[model samples]
Each structure stands twice: as C-alpha cells, then as structure tokens.
Target chain A: MFRHNTLRYAVLVLLASAALFQAFTAEYFGLEILTEILILAMLVLALDIVAGFGGMVSLCHGALMGVGAYAYALLSTTAGIAPPVAMVGAVALTGAIAWAIGAICSRSHGIYFIMATLAFGQMAYSYVFEAPIFGGDDGLGGIARLDLSFVGIDLNDSRSFALFCLVVLGAIYGVSVLILRSGLGRSLTGVMHNEQRMRALGLTVWRVKADVFGLSGMIAGLAGVLAAQHIMYISPGLLSWTVSGEALVVVILGGLGTLVGPLVGAAAFVVLKHELSAVTTYWHLVVGVILIAVVMSRANGIFGWIEARWGDRIERRLSDTTRKPEAKEVLGDA
Target chain B: MLETRNLDKSFGAVHVTRNVSLKLERGERRIILGPNGAGKTTLFNQLVGELTPDSGSVHLAGEDVTALPVAKRARRGLSRSYQKNTLFDGLTVEENLGLATAVHTGNATQLWSDSLAKPEVREIVNEVAEQVNLMPYIHAKVSEISYGVRRQLEVGVALATRPLVLLMDEPTSGVGPEMSKGFHDLLNNLPRDLTMLIIEHDMDLAFDVADTITVLNYGEVVFDGLPEAARGSKLLKDIYLGNWEDA
Candidate 1:
C-alpha cells in the first residue's frame, strides 16, 4: 500500500548507520580511509549522474573535481576567502566550467564524446601542472578544513572531520536520489534511451545533457572540497585522466545506474587498493583482474548483484505486509 | 498546416529528394505512397529539420522553419514517428508517452517534481495511450513488448507531443493484415482536425485513410491527386505494376 521505495530507503538507512558507526568508533587511520572512501564515493555518484543516466560518459569529471579543489585551495590561501565561502565559490565555478564543456562536447556522441572529455581533462591537467601560481607539479598545501570550530566542533580532529564528510556524502546521496525521481531524471533517461526520439518530442537534447553535466559537476566539486580538506593538499594528480578513468572503473565495478552501488564500489575499490598495495606495488593489475571478474560475472556490478538477489524479495515482503490488511478488509466487505 | 517547396537534397550526385513540393492544409490527411529509395523519408527529414534541403524551404503554420533545428521545428508543432521503431526501450510504455508529454508541456526541465505526478502530463499520456490503443500494455517495458506494439508506441510517443502536424513514417510497416486493419481503425478514430502526412506502402491502408494521395518515384512526385483519381491514374498503375486492382 505504501508507494515509497522501501528497499532503497532501507539500504540508505543501513549505509548511513554503518558510516555513523565507523565515524564514532574508527581509529585515526580508519577515519582517514573512511573519509577518502566517502569523498571518492561522492565523486563516483556525480559521475553516475551523466555516465549512467544521461548516457554521456565523461572523462573530464576528475578535472572538474580538480578545478574545485584548486579553486578552494587558492581562494582560501591566496584570495584569503573563508573556507565555507570558498567551497561554494569553487563548486559554482566548477559547475560553470563543466556546463561549457558539456555544451561543446554535446556535439559529439559515443566514442567522440569520450575523446572530447579526455581532451578537456588533459588540458586541465596540463595547465595545472605548468601554471606557476599553482606551484606547478609541487601542488598547493596548507589548505584548511571547513572551520566550524566556533560551533564547538573541531574539524581538525579526524573523527569530527570524517563525520562531516559522511554527512555531506549522505546529503549528496539523498539529493541524487531525489533528482533521479524527478522530471529531469526521467528526461535524462529518455534522452539516453533514444536521443533522436527526444529531439522529435521537442526536447533540446544537448541542453538537457549540458544541464545534467553541470549539476553532476557541482556534486563532483563538493567531493573535491571534501577531498582537499581530507588531505590538506591539492595536486595536479586530481586533474589527471587516470583519476577520471579510475572513477569510471569504480562506477562500473559498483553498477551503472544504481546510486548506492557506486558507494559500495568506491568502498570496495579503496579497501582493495589499500589492502593489496600493502603487499604488492602491482595493485593495479590485481584490481584490473577483479574488475574484469566483476564485469564478467555480474554485468550490473556487486551492488546490482546483491539487489538482484535480494531486492525483489524485500519489495515483495513490504508489499505483502501492506496488502494483507487490505485483503482482509475486502473479504469482510464481501 | 505543413508545407514544403521545391525541396531538393543530393548526396554527392545521387539525388535523394528532387524538387519535392507538397502542401497540407489544416485537417488534411495526405498519404504518401512510394517504393524503396523513393526519398519519402528524406522528404519527411527535411520537413522536420533533420536534414536541411540544398535549395528549398519548409514552412509550418506559415512560418519558414527551414533554418531551424530539429527540436525547434518540433517545438513549432511538427512531430514524426520513425520508419524504424525509435522508442525508449528502457522505459515503460506509459513512461515513453509521459516523457513526450512532459517535454511538450514545458515540464521536461523541472528537476524538483515528479513528471508523471503532474496531472497535465498524466492526462496527455493516458490520452495518447488510449489513442494508440496501448492502454492494455501501458505498464509494459518497450523492450519486452512485441514488434507490433512497438510500432503503435512509436506513434503514441509522437501523438503525446500534441503536434499540429504529425508525420508518421510507416506506422504499420511490418504488421499482419489483421493487425494492420486494427491500426487503420486506430488512425481513423483519431481527432479529425489533427493534420497528418503518412508515408504508407499498403494500398489498402493508403486508399482507406487518405483524403489525398501523392506518389513518389526516384525522389520525385509522380502523381498527386485525390485517392479515387490516384486509383485510376495510368502513371500510378505503371508504378505499382497493376497492383491497383488488388486493393
């Protein structure tokens, strides 16, 4: 009888509780890992917005995140702006930049679109690597966290900062879910499914793609802000095409369109990388093997596989619970 | 009303559309009959702004939209269904209709609200579903549906846009005779004032639904007249290889 997505809500609750538990109980190193996973999860979530739903597989998301991180770092250190205001300005700037890129790249489709995004990503990476004001390859350090010390929350502490990142990630996940259920999400899905049909139906398909890309960029920017705070440094590596490629890998390894899957994917990816790299420097090869296995065994990814196994059962149970009383009432009436 | 004048398109010496001029008044049903490579689809493309004519103009509601893009032309009340089934196969039949209606009603960009929750979009989706006789399969995924149902959905999506001029390219291209008759009935039941330019191969459907007929051969309009006159035209008989009497 309840029309809400019970299973999705349940999964979100479970993930949130787990994140909170880790935030409260994790050690310093554990908190660092958790914060890294949360930030990367947010970035992958942003990637999914366009890649999974909008069918625009962008390779410039890492660069977009870099723009946010650089902007936040510069505004706080050089421009002398406050951390929170810099965060907002960085996100807006990244969104504007991504919107322009998306508008230009919208002219290309499929492989061409991917190449166009790669070109943009490489351009950003090269600029950041060569620019003297950015300290070139050395990157900029001494970036501050979103100072909430006046509110009695010391973000300098790992636990407090991790909790803050968890909160931001949760908010982003919630907003993403809302966007997916909204009209724009449906339009994006329609555009992905049949762009020609969308155009025939009077939709400016490129505009829709560009708008979603901009929204996705803002989310990636938020992730970038959190990431800079987590590391207290900004580097050109953040803008590298390899970063974009890795994010794309996480998106696929988790599952394409499933929002929560990307979080699971990011966590799995970070944990795997951390654990494997401890033993072997050739962790990329091992991760690649695992990715291949996941892609082969489950086309939907690990989260999708989990949902495929249990999602229907949970939905049916919820509906059954609601329908029983209605059935009884109908029987009594008859 | 949709009108095309002297629409000529060539692909490097091969003329796909040759001096094709046509006019459809308000509330008119014009059926285009042509064999393969006749450039009927090309003509429709030019009219809908998918392919621009080399030296011609397309007008919709007395405005020349020859320079406008596909979406802009569609916004000015020109909509088309593809010869092939071009549908959102990932979505349900109702979602397919809802998306078209959402875009048509200017609610496509609304990011905060549910599109299907809007009463206007739902109403139009339901209406178009009923119009296409797809109410029974409204909840079915387009990919899971049969080929014939997809054909109906292709038109349903176009109708949901609430177009002033609807161009349907082979709405019943592959259906059996029985289903084709049903599709014909569906077309006949549509609102009389909805102007339509249909490219059809079936003579039974062509003669049955057409108020006027235009025959295309080698990218040129060979004959254009009333259906009764088209039936008796010697040129049409020659083009059809005396298949006129079979209908």
Candidate 2:
C-alpha cells in the first residue's frame, strides 16, 4: 500500500532535493565524496532487500557488488563496449549470480544461509585474487571512464560524474522501492515470521527467497558498476566477505527495511570513516563503538524508531488501490 | 482414507515404533491412546512425513506417499498440528490465519501482495476463521492470547491446508475444561470426508468422540478396537493402572 511506503517516497523526494543544493558555491569541493555516500546508500538498500525484507542474513552481497564491478570493468574497458551496454551487462552478470547463490543458499535458513552466502563470497574473492588476467592481488587498473557517445560530457571531471552517480542511485532506489512494496514483499515478511506457515499457505518459500536475493543483488550490482566507474579501478578485495559484512553492518546501523535507513547508515559510515581515519590511527575502534551503541540502543533502527513514533497516523489512511505510478507518492503499500 | 502399514521406526537401541499398523477410513474418527512413551507422537510424525519409517509404507487415499516430504504430504490433503503450538510469535492472529489461508490454497510464494487487495483470499480466510469461531481475536497476536487460542491457531494452520487426513497431536494436552468444548465443537463440525487421527490422553473425550481407539503400551498395540470393546477389555484400565488392573 502507498500509505505504508510514504516515508520511502518522501525520502526519495528529499534525496532528489539535493539537486537544488548543487548550485550553491560552497558545495563544489564536497560533491564527489557525497556522491560516493549516495552510491553506498544504494548498496545498503540492496543489502536490505535480502536481510531486512526477506530475512536472509547474507554476508556475500559485497561479492555480488564485485560481480557488477567486474562486469563493468571488463565490458567497458577490455571488451570495448559503451558505458550503457556495460551497465546492463553488469546487472545481468550480478543478477544471474545472485539468483544462483540465492537458490542454493536459500535451501538453508538462519545461520546456515549466512555461512553459505559467505562461502560463495569467499569463492568469488579467491577467484579474483588468483586469476592472472584480472591483475591478481594488485587488481585491474587502467579502467576507463564512462563515454556517453553523445552526451559530450567528460566523465573524468568530478562534478559531472557525481551527478551521474546520484541519478543512478535514485533510479536504483526507485526499483528497490517498487519491488519491496509489491505483493512479493508481503510474502517476504511472512517468511521472516514463519517459513512453515508460509509453506502451508501453499507458497514456494524457496522461490520467493531466491527472487528476493536476486532483487537485492541486482541493486547491489548496479551500485557496484557505478562504484567501479567512480573509482576507475577494480580490485579483488571488492569481492571480500569483509565488504559484505560492512554492508550488513550498514543495514543494521541504518535500521533494517526502513526505506531511508540505508541512506542514513551510509552517511554515518562514510562521514565517520573519512573524518575519523584522517584524525585517528584507531578509527575502526570508534566506528565499532558507534556500531555497538546503535545495535544495543536501537533494535527498530533510527528510521524505524521514527516510524514507530507516528506509524498510527500513516496506518489510518487506506491504500487498497496500489500499483499505479500516479500513486508513487502514496507509498501506503507500494 | 489414510493408512500406515507395518511402519517400523527406531532411535538407536530404543525402538519408537515396532511394526505399528493402523488405518482410518474417510470420515472416520480414530483416537490413539498410549502410555507416556508408547510412540504415538512418532507414529504421527511418520504419517505426516516428518519421520521416515525403517520399513513398510504409508498411503493417502490409496496413493503411496511413504517417501514424500512433510510439505508435499500436506499438499496432498494431509495436515498435522504440533502438540506445541508452532505459530509465529511476531505475527498477529489475522496474519497467522491469513497465512493458514495461503497454506489452504497453497500460494506461499506471493511475496509482497497487499493482503487488503486480495478479495478472494480474504473470503477464504474469513470463511475458515468463522468455521473455527476465531473471528473475534483474528487481529490478536499469538503471544497475547491464551493456551486455548494458541492451540486453535495451530489447528487453524492445519485446517488452512484443507487436508483429507488431519493428524492432531495431543489436541487437548494443556487445555482448560471450558476451552475443550470449543475444540470439540470445531472438530464435530468438520466435513465427514476429512478423516482424522488424534493422539490424546483424556479417556473421557476419547470415549466420547473416537469411533475407533488404538491403545499403545510399549511401542506396540496393546488393544485395537471400538471404544466399547476397548473399555470392556481389562487392557483399557491396564494401560493406566498397570498389570494389577488387568489382573
């Protein structure tokens, strides 16, 4: 229902409102970093697709991001493909891998699924680490920037690319929002509560789980493609389980499935990492402490708590009429 | 019509079911009465495809379903409720019943469809909930309700499956006497085509409702007959009073 998803749509509107600040003279130097934060938000949103909505505790989402990054890096550079083609290719590659992993790993739930996804991620990491053509441990360098062919914009310039990344993030968020607000998302909520009941309901719980993972992976992969372009390089470490762990941490910190929770979490992570690492040798310690505090103090998450405060007001509105683009702002169940 | 033939199960040296065989014709009410460790639960598990019998087979409506998984068996008109309520703690009563509705129709894969949008699904759930008389507290959470309500939730879960053979494990193990009638009424009104094998300890209810009674003493049938034949034989009281009662 559009009513349930009002907050998500509002967050989208708020994020889009960032374009208004682009003209501000003082914001020029900070554009690239903020753009990176937005992309990170996209990644966190993708992670939430599985962990929060589907109840899959995946630690391999980062590796899925790696798949996208690799696809972009290979197609855009080595394969001499255009950026648009590379982007589509990246999504296809990552989404396929996500589906495969989801199908196999979804057979096991709770901690077992966690370990299975981790195992697959580690396998991807190892493949990237040892493959000679991929530059091995040194990583694949000399990755070219996106060439629009007709837009006539030089992507090497920081601000133009930052805007591009932000736009892409917005699109990805929209896609994720659409999927989560659909009938499919409701079944995912059911899975989170009780799988047995779901089976009795005559649901093929595995397929729904696989589909959830694939959706999240596609979004994560899209973010990864953008990230590789933004950084102009691809590394084997992109597929590391630690990166997946970080994504999981972001979802938790932001609050699981709370629409804008990922954005807040990404901002917290990016800002804290950039500012703290510049100042202290033990930056992770501070981030770790913050994480502990967030986890301990807020089970519903930052945005979740916000929703809980005024959820009654949102629930009062009826949203039986969903599935129309005109009602995107309605978010009741969208 | 459900039947298990020569079903044998064991846990290492301890045999849980030794050549146990039973059958329930369509519309028949069969109660299984046994001592504490007489493999009643084991038999239910085997029938529901949660446990594999070491030998022999199970048939539902004349179709061999010995190797089917639990959910698969459920799909083929076979449903069983846990002695312990397996309801999800996080969901409200309506949602749980809604899930049961989904199970009944077998559409567990619709991930995110807004429940309010599905008129057909809502109608089915409302009908079943009405039948079970759980409409009053449909929106209540499982944890917020009483033991009787919890049991009904479990039963509702099985009923949602709309099975041909309903297997209930200790349908009234911890229920108050007043709550028992609700269950009795619910069961009494069930379609005659839906056969049920109930495991229970209450002798009064067993005699009151069961058309056929199977008594297990030590992982084996001590008495298998009609309730009158079971009650007339000394073995009926012997299961409760030990060897001295039979003497």
Candidate 3:
C-alpha cells in the first residue's frame, strides 16, 4: 500500500523546483524561507511516525527537537567539534531522551499519554529555560556549523547550504519510506489495533513503541541540528508546547496517517502565515478557519482529497488494465 | 494443573469472589455454569490475572503464580478467550495470528523497527489459521469479518499461544447453530494435555464437550462431578436458571 506514487513524485519535484528557483533567481531571503520549509518537512514527517502511524499522538516533539538542537550546540562549542559529528551526537542523545519519555508515557495510552508527553517535553523546556550554563533563556548562541573543508565547498554560502538541507531532506524521506514498509511498521500498526493481542503474542509492545518514538525524535533531531546552524540562534521559545501543538496542527492540516501529509501541512502552514500576515494582523484566525474546514470534510488531507476524488479513478483504470485475469473474481467478490 | 484457594475480591463492599477455591488436574476439562451476576466472568478475570484477588493464591503447574501480571500469566501457559469476541480490528488475520504464535514461543522482540516477514512467523500463522478453519479468511481484516468468524479467529489466536490451560467464556455466544456445531467439534478435539476451563450458557454444548461440570451459584460451587451426575442434579439447573428463592 506504501510505495512511490504520483503524489510523492510531485511533491519531490515541487521541492526541487523551489530549490532551483532559490538557487538561480531568488535572493538569500527566499533561499532561507525555502530551507525552513524543507527542514520543517523533515520534522513534521518525524512527528507523523508516532502520531499518525503508531497512534501515539505526542505534543512534546518540539521539546525533543530542542534536545537535538542543544546537543549540536553544546557538543560543537564544548569540544570544538565539527558539525557532522555534532549532528550525530545530538541525534543519539535526543534519541535516548525520547526513549525515556516514550517508555514512561507509552504506559499511559490515549489522551493521558499525550498530556504526559507534553508535561515531560515542558520539563525539558524548563530545564533549558532555567539552566544558567546553557545560556539560560537566551540559549547557547555561539555554536558553529560543521567546517566541511574536505568536500572543497564553502557551506557559508546560502546557495550551498540550501543544497545541504535538500540532500538531508531526500535522505530522511528515503529512510522514512523504508521504515514504514518494514516488518516493524506492520507491528506498530498492530499495536494501534490491539496492544493486548500484541502483548499476548509475547511482544515487548512498550519497548517497541518507545524505540520507534525515539527514532522519530532522532529524525526530528536531524532537522533541529540543521535549523540551529542555519538560524545561528536558539531560544526557549523553540521548545514551547505551543510549537509542538502547531506542528501537530500542521500535521492535521495536511492530513493524518499520510506520508506526505505533514510536509504539505508544514509548507502550507509557513506559506499561509507568511502571505496572510502581510495582509492582516489576525492571520491565525483565517488559517484556523481553513484548518477547520479541511478537517470537517474528512477529505483524507489536501492530497488525500485530491487522491480520493481524482486519484481513485486513475488507479481504478490502472488496476483494470493490469488485472484483467482476476477481474471475474474481483467483480464477483464485490 | 491449575488451582485457586480462598480467593476473595470486593468492589466497595460487594464481594465478587468470596473464599472461592477449586483445583483441576492436567487434561481435565471443567465447565463453570451459572446465571448472570454469578461472578463467573469476575472469577475468570481474577484467575487470568486481569483482576487481583485480595486474599487467595493462584498456582499453575504447582508454582505460586498469584503475583504474576496478565502478560506473564499468558506467558506462563495461561490463555483466555473473552465472552465477547476480542479480535484486533485493524489487523489482518495473518498478522494477529502471527502475534499469537510469537506469544507461545516467548519471543518478546516487539520493537516496531523489526520485521515480521520472517518465514518462521509466516509458517506458524498459516498453521494456526489452518487449525481454526480460518485459512479462507487469512487475508481479511478482522473488523470486516462477522462475529461468528471473529469468535473462531479469537480461538485461533488462543491456540497460537500453545497454552497449557485454556479459559474460554461463552465461545458460542452469537454463533449460528451450524457454526456452533463446528466449533463444538473443534473444541472437543483440542489436545488432551491442554487443561480446559469453560463457561457456557448452552447446556447441550456443555454436556457434549465437558468431562466434568462445575456449577457456580452466587460465587459458590453447587456441583463438581461428571456430566451425567451434573445433569441429574436439580441444584445445578436451579443455579443456572436463576431460581435462587429456595436456596
């Protein structure tokens, strides 16, 4: 059921074309916005793994993202390390943090789990919020990007940097696809269906969920590492529960349980906020209304609706041509 | 292979199980029959470790298992079926049954990142699905199936665990007469070494399958003997039919 389709290809193409536009015609400002969209797409995809697929709707992802960001900042500054090493270290540390939170929170499933993760995430935020050594509320601002001299390219250039983010996004998307198609993905879906049966089968259901939830946090960490370097700034606001809620809202806005839903949601979210804020002070009201409309329609998501109304007919014809031999049984069964 | 002594449970003064005690030998099939509110389900829940007993002991195969949780109880060769069909609705039959096989094998590797496409899991799932007459419905999602079929699927799930003891409550609650007969034959032929404890409202099915009958009335045993002896006991009928005025 999960494979490369027109939607995936189209979204990838759309991302590529936008990157090309920034690389050639647009100024550094346009390139910066494009980079934010691309990286946020990665973070939203990570959020989707636990919330959309595994049925663990967490609101602490932004705080976990902070864990990654801080990991990169501290490792690079304290050890005078390169960015690549810092990114890896950050993701590993964040993965561990996510696993701890997941282990504790997965015990309490449903809405309580969401609230529990939210509380834990807030705890992380407040730790950074109050810790004087980590720059307190101002964040660790003096961190540096990886000095990638071996590649014979200056990452200081916004054009080159955008390319780095693009490549990272492509790699994460590929890995996400692989994970979603594996046996683990099937079991995670099974957990959502019946944890009791999963437990009865002698599965360490909690550990599995906690691990995957940690994996999602690691991916989000990757995005956070990229964002921290690009922005050259970090603050307590980044780890706020509202930011996590917004990410969730973006996921819901794009679509739930769809691979590309969160990406579209994030992009659409940033773009709408950018364009609408230019027109009026109350942009959120308008975005909220659109979000409400999309959810109420139960249209699967933006592309989900597009696929339902338009994509189905196309698929139906494709199946009809390829499965002529099974047509009798297929029609008879229906 | 299983026994409980002086089991007592209370929900704010309503004593669910009061000093309930019973024992069974390996290969013995005991059916617990009673009317509604007889605490049959509650007692089953306690024995299955879903509910804790305030003052009793649960032993399995001569080991004290009173402190074990539900998952451990299941792993210790205790499997149960609900009065209602408890199928994992979002999963396909093969996937659910595959999990059941994994349970009995005691494979606790449930990390979501691991693959379930191994040939071992596939082979075991097919075998159990075949055993429960669910081969034709292997690919079907449980939610899309009928209750009668779901009941069979639940049985397939239980059988996959390879339990030393099987506790089934109302296995034929909503089944058709024809399918009920099929399930009866299937239950009757289960491995003799599997200690069976059942609760059924259907008297004919009970007499046809059970080696011995245990009638429970108001959380107390009224009879425990052979099927012929149980059928001849007026007290058993009176308990089952809820005629408690004389008692």
Which is the leading candidate under lDDT?
1
lDDT of 3 by residue, B80-183 (tens): 88888777776677867866765565333433333446666677788878778887777777766677888988888888888898888888888889889988
Q: Name the candidate, 2 or 3, with the larger TM-score value.
A: 3
What's the alpha carbon RMSD for model 2?
5.6
What tens digits encode model 3's per-residue C-alpha lDDT throughout A59-119? 9999988889888988888777777888899999988889888888888888899999999
Docking class of 3: acceptable
Better of 1 and 2 by TM-score: 1
- Index of the highest-TM-score prediction: 1
Best by DockQ: 1
Each model's fraction of native contacts: 0.76, 0.39, 0.33
Error of 1 at A321 (Å): 5.9
Task: Name the runs in model 2 displaced over 4 angstroms.
Answer: A1-29, A109-111, A141-184, A196-205, A257-259, A298-300, A304-334, B103-106, B243-247
Question: What residue pairs clash in candidate 1, if any at all?
Answer: none
State which docking tier applies to candidate 2: acceptable
Q: Each candidate's chain A: what TM-score?
A: 0.93, 0.87, 0.94
